[model samples]
Target chain A: MAKVNRSLTGTMGRSWLKDAQFTPLAFLAPTIVLLVAFAFIPMIWGLALAFTDYPILLSPKFIGLDNFRRLKDDPVFWASLRNTFSYIIGTVPPRIILGFVVALLLNQAIRGRNILRAMFYFPVVAPLVSVSLLWQWMFNTHFGVINGILRMLGRAPVPWLTSSKYALPAVMIMSVWKTVGWNMVIFLAGLQGISPSYYEAAEIDGANRWQCVRHITLPLLRPIILLALVISTINSSKVFEQVYIMTGGGPGYSTMTLVQQVYHSAFQSYEMGYASAISLVLFAIVMILSVIQFKYLGARTDE
Target chain B: MLRKFSVALSTMLALMLLISFAAAAAPAELRFLWWESPQRVESIQRLIDEYEKAHPDVSIKLESIPWDEYWQKLPILIAAGRAPDIMFMVSGNVQRYAEMNALLDLREPYVSQEVIDEMYEPHRAMVTYQGKISALPFTLTTVTPFYNKDHAAKAGIEPPMTPENAWTWEEFKLAAAKMKQAAGSPYGVGLGTRDFWLLPFIYQNGGAVLNEARTGSAINSPESEEALAFLQELVTEGIAASPVDQSVGDLFPAGLMPMSFGGHWDMARFETVITDFDYGVTFFPQRKTSGVGLGGDFLAVYSKTPYPKEAAEFVAWLTSAEANGQYIAENYYLSPRQGAKVTYPSRQEEMNLAQKQAELASVRLTADRAIPAWDKFLQVIHSEFQMVMIGDKKPADGLKAIESAINKTLQ
Candidate 1:
């Protein structure tokens, strides 16, 4: 028995239990356990739930692909998916471009640059609930500041939050204002990291400011921009708080997003299976979009 | 002398041990959970203190969650077997919880039939599920028309003070228009578009939202269509504030609207803020019938509570006339008890009018409204009706959509 124990611990399992690896593993055990318990296990369970009929009151029954089959015919599900995509398209590019432009302007020695940066960042730091409420008031049709300005200019008041035609756009505008600062700060960091000598060399070649930015700055910032795009698209696809607070996805189902639908299905309707199915579809969309972004942007970055 | 002193010390030690054991074994520590406004929470806490003082063998740990998160967390807690011994429930959730067997039936053995029958008819209906008393109604919030007196004076309209004097639907509309004409645009009637608030109109129009058997939709009937069209016209013609952009609570208190629909609970806030204008509560206008929406909280015992008998007794005590009177008087909320005595600190006239409205109110339940999925149905209702109110869809089309959606939920 003693000889067998020596061989097991000393020969085969010697490196596996070595101090170097064992110490790090011991240190990481808590985090790994937490991730498995909270994130990984729930993810696997959610995927399994998508294949069952779980109303949360009774025991779950395996229903195979019925949930997915139902999704194919669910109009609300289709509408929410369309709205999610529209939100991604409407908010992500404008945010990235505006953030970049603002970053570039602030990168120069301008008056009150620090104050301007802080002013831009304030909205990002504000609590989303308060910001959504503030924007709701600002978008009020009768006495809102926006309408106040419109009326002052002798123009008709727009029912910004109360109309289906403009609700999503209003949400998009608030989202951009609230989040542009985050992207700006990221782009500013990327811009500052670029070597000044590259710009100097380009300038010596009689390159204009636009050409210098076009060739050197844009190339250097490609990876950062890709990072922002992937992050923003994933986050924007899950939009809920603003739409929930501002319009409650209302005036019709015009402002409903995929995550809000998930909430409605799971909590409001108590259909866990259907909600999981919706979530699985959302997960696939986000994953595929991220992969496509990487495929295109990553290739350019490498060059 | 030393021996005597040692004996006395031993005796004292023995007595101390006995007292500590009694202290540890006493007090069952029942967990009570509820969702209410801060003012009501204080009132509930006082009731808990009074109950604890009266029953020396029991103590309560109070848990209050905000209304929005309460329903979402409650079923999960009950399913996990971690439910509170006593829980606050609403009328809409009573049927679902009873069907789930999560609530204790307060029938014969737990509560006598006489006591259950003693409750107001609508309140009794709210708690009854398949002839079983699922919960006992404690307080009620009934809708009444709250009007700005100054606006009414300007429009030369006397608000209805009694059901007999209630205006017809056409009269109500003409009055609203006159008020708008006198008091500028957006200052007429402030209407709420949610289904619960909208039910009064349907009821007054002699249209039921669901069939008699509660198996299908009755909202597509001509009566319902006319009722909905009338409401839509109020918004579209600028006789009512746009439900989309303005909250009636805000507009009413700001003196911007001549009249608005509010509940007994809304009186507290309105009383505090409407210093610029005097307001009065009265019966809602009548058409084919005189009716308004009825809703409130109920006290229920968790079926799985280890101390079921104690929990039931406590819930009974909490809803008793004496305890309910104290709570109602302090909060200005209406009691569900038939003859509960309560004295308002002020505004007795308005309170009396509200009480009259509640007495006329009926508890409206449909097959879809009683299920766990009713919240989703209400969301559909809100969206569909909002489309009509915003002029994107006709009332008939919206009603059709609602009918189909509700039938789908029933299935």
Candidate 2:
């Protein structure tokens, strides 16, 4: 009787374990296969090509590390690297600060709060291509609305898009406008997740609103803030569309960035191997940055 | 028996509909890809329709890609071994394609020397690389300077009507100064640093992009510096608009600026948009000689094409006098073929001007602009030109930098 009972229980346990593991795998197979085929396989292929001399029109010959050796002495690559770094530093901080402050403000009791929130979030939902195109007209050196208004105010016309001095800043301005709303939405959710009871408790302990925010709200929002920064770093580093559409990376290549260089080398010059080498350098830089962020910032909250 | 007879008759009629007029002959599908302005799509489609009607056994599939994206797509298509049978080629495109052994040589087997000689010299030279005719020039364009007639009239300056009578560098500057002094603020000339605009100045100053052998860049020489200095003075003196002030000057009505450099496509737009004012176009103002940059689109058959004869025949028909005349009339392009007779029915005057421009272009069109590294060379030149135009770099330094970059690319 004891043996029969044990055998039945073992059978039941095995069946339960099988069903638990089988269902999710069956559901996830298509997505996993697609990711491997499209993303992983291409990445590996690109990695291999980074070491070759594969001009797109010509047959690719394996010339190991030659592309990378050329990159060491390339001045244009260095200039583009500088411009990309400047773009990120110039745009990302403002975006995050503006977004968080607005999100904090909107979280409070205000008039037509939902409507205000919706207005702030509208640009986030709008397409980047359309937004950048609109900005292009707005930044036109002569007949743009901004210059028109400046002229009406008795000021000299500014060459917003044409001048090398101003073109990168103009692009940065557009990027900030496009991105702040997205970060605001994310920060808003994090702001809302904080319990009001903690604030009340702080208030009871003779803490002012600023003090309570300093001690409680910020600490609670740390993980979300870190995540937003990491994502912002990735997005700003990979900025291509805005620079491409607005400037064509010109006026002495003042606004040329890394991804634009990759695109130019690959598509325009037909130097695929060289482009891949540039891309790998970017990928490694991004990885190092991401790892640093995860280690220093992510460790604080995940623990 | 009567019902069975009726069913059999109906079945035979249905089978007849399934069979084409060519009687079970398999159609050879030729994919033809090109970039076209929206206005020209209808005309191109009409040409394709005519070609298809002429050859019942050959079906031509027309694909249109955006001009800005064509280079990016073309290489991928060729590398993937899925390139179209026939493609539209431009001056800078054929050299690369020919180098890759991707284009079929039209000199022998496909076309004869007599037929090639029928094209304008510059247009013919444009499609030739390594002594081989790689493609056939279908349309020609020479950069022409368009001036606002009303602006000139207001400034009491009568701009010259032909290259021979046009302003010298000093005279052009004086006219610009007079216009600015009269009109105020928007300036007189819209300076362009692009290849068509800047290269012509180099040619007009007795400079070419390269030596006759096309061995190296000639832009580092004294004449090239003189050409750049002329432009540099206009920029720094604030006589003409710099990119910092405005790029190619966004002045509209095509009539606000006294002069602007443009191509044939601008002719169509000016006709429509310049209704508020009147504009006149003339040959590029000369320095040492009257010259203009000549460039155009061409047709090339892919070496991998399954039906080379049919593709070549179609391209030949498309570039023939009758087809090209209609194409030019509808599309506002100048013809490349000798005696192609491109008469823009209502605008016979513009057609006459186009002929004059084409004639001027041939005098200085041959250069290193046809090198396989043409695109990269352009990039370096464009950057250096911008630097000089913006008053940031000295003309000598800019030219030296451009020459160095070109040498690096060539190596």
C-alpha lDDT values of all predictions: 0.83, 0.80
> Which segments of candidate 1 are over 4 A away from where they belong?
A1-20, B1-25, B363-368, B371-373
* lDDT of candidate 1 over A95-135, digit per residue (tens): 99999999999999999999999999999999999999999
In terms of TM-score, how similar is model 1 to the real structure? 0.93
Candidate 1 lDDT, B171-244, residue by residue in tens: 88898888777767565787775666777788778887778767778889898888879878877887876656
Candidate 2 lDDT, B278-332, residue by residue in tens: 7776656787776676787889999889889888888887877778778777656
List runs of model 2 lying over 4 Å from the truth. A1-20, A147-157, B1-24, B243-250, B362-366
**TM-score of the second chain, cand. 2:** 0.90
Please give the range of 10 consecutive residues that has the lowest summed lDDT in model 1 chain B: B364-373
Each candidate structure's TM-score, on Cα atoms with residue i matched to residue i, is 0.93, 0.91
Give the range where candidate 1 chain A is weakest over 10 consecutive residues by summed lDDT. Answer: A12-21
Question: What global local distance difference test value does model 1 have?
Answer: 0.83
